[model samples]
Target: MACGEIITEPLMVAAIDLGTTFSSYAFATRGEFKDDPTKISSYAWCTGSQPGLSLKTPTCILFDKVQNFFAFGAEAEDKYTELAQGGGPHTLVLL
Candidate 1:
């Protein structure tokens, strides 16, 4: 495939936007796009800082004391906040 050429394959396309403060992902299948070019599917993140639904989630990662994966996105923020309030040791990585 050439850089300037359009892809003619019938497949699903996904994209991730990893921003400094927030992150989001969107996807669409070829058939879906054909039906509605402006239609795309994305997840709604429920963050602690913000009420209701949000398009993007906080770009944060939480790990256990042993460096194991704990949570991501809004869950990560909530967990980290809990740990901090309870004076628990945890590793938080902000992306």
Candidate 2:
């Protein structure tokens, strides 16, 4: 071990699944994965029109006419719904 040597820490890793109708993310620390590879976490997303959470979110995206990103998942659904009902200006990409 040299006194001038630098120490570096292991970085966390993440996995993302982009499905045709859904999307999800999972992550785990390097040490945690080494100890137990199955130790990963994912978030439960909210489906705007639904009453409960979902394992993953819908693959819907929203943006303004000027190309400004708006939302994703259920939020995008809600925003699109709002635009459709209220006649607002926005673009929705649904899959």
Candidate 3:
């Protein structure tokens, strides 16, 4: 680091998977060049769930064409379940 250099705060960021019918995130951050006893930069920068854990989170969002908003995650799943239980005219479509 340069003398009197302003060290910016570290942060985590990610982009979601928009086309796979699910949400996803990708990210990056500065890497350490020297080994230090304490203070290591965050290894995983962007991911849906948590990076480096073999897990990823999807960024899929579902909407009601008529309602014009969104019913996300388990909420969307529950809506499907409700339609099933009542044997309504609901159908599943991927966007």
State every prediction's TM-score relative to the real structure.
Answer: 0.78, 0.74, 0.35
Per-residue alpha-carbon lDDT of candidate 3 for residues 4-85, written as tens digits (9 for 90 to 100): 9876754433445454544434554433322332433332223322333322333344566565546554345555566678
Residue 61, candidate 2: C-alpha displacement in angstroms: 0.9
The candidate with the higher lDDT, 1 or 2, is 1
Q: What are the RMSD figures for all models against the true structure?
A: 4.0, 4.8, 8.9
Clashes of each: 0, 0, 10
For candidate 1, lDDT tens digit of each residue in 1-95?
Answer: 76888876858999999998899999999999999999999998886666789989888888776777888888888877777788865566433
Instruction: Indicate which candidate wins on TM-score.
Output: 1
Q: Model 2 scores what on Cα lDDT?
A: 0.80
Cα error, residue 80 of model 2, in Å, equals 0.6
- Model 2 misplacement above 4 A: 1-10, 87-95
Regions of model 3 farther than 4 Å from truth: 1-12, 19-21, 26-60, 65-67, 89-95
TM-score comparison, 1 vs 2, better candidate: 1
Q: After superposition, how far is residue 95 of candidate 3 from its true place, in Å?
A: 4.5
Per-residue accuracy of model 2 over 1-30 as CA lDDT, tens digit each:
579776465468778999988899989998
- Candidates ranked by lDDT: 1, 2, 3
lDDT of each: 0.83, 0.80, 0.46
- Which 10-residue window of candidate 2 scores lowest in summed lDDT? 86-95
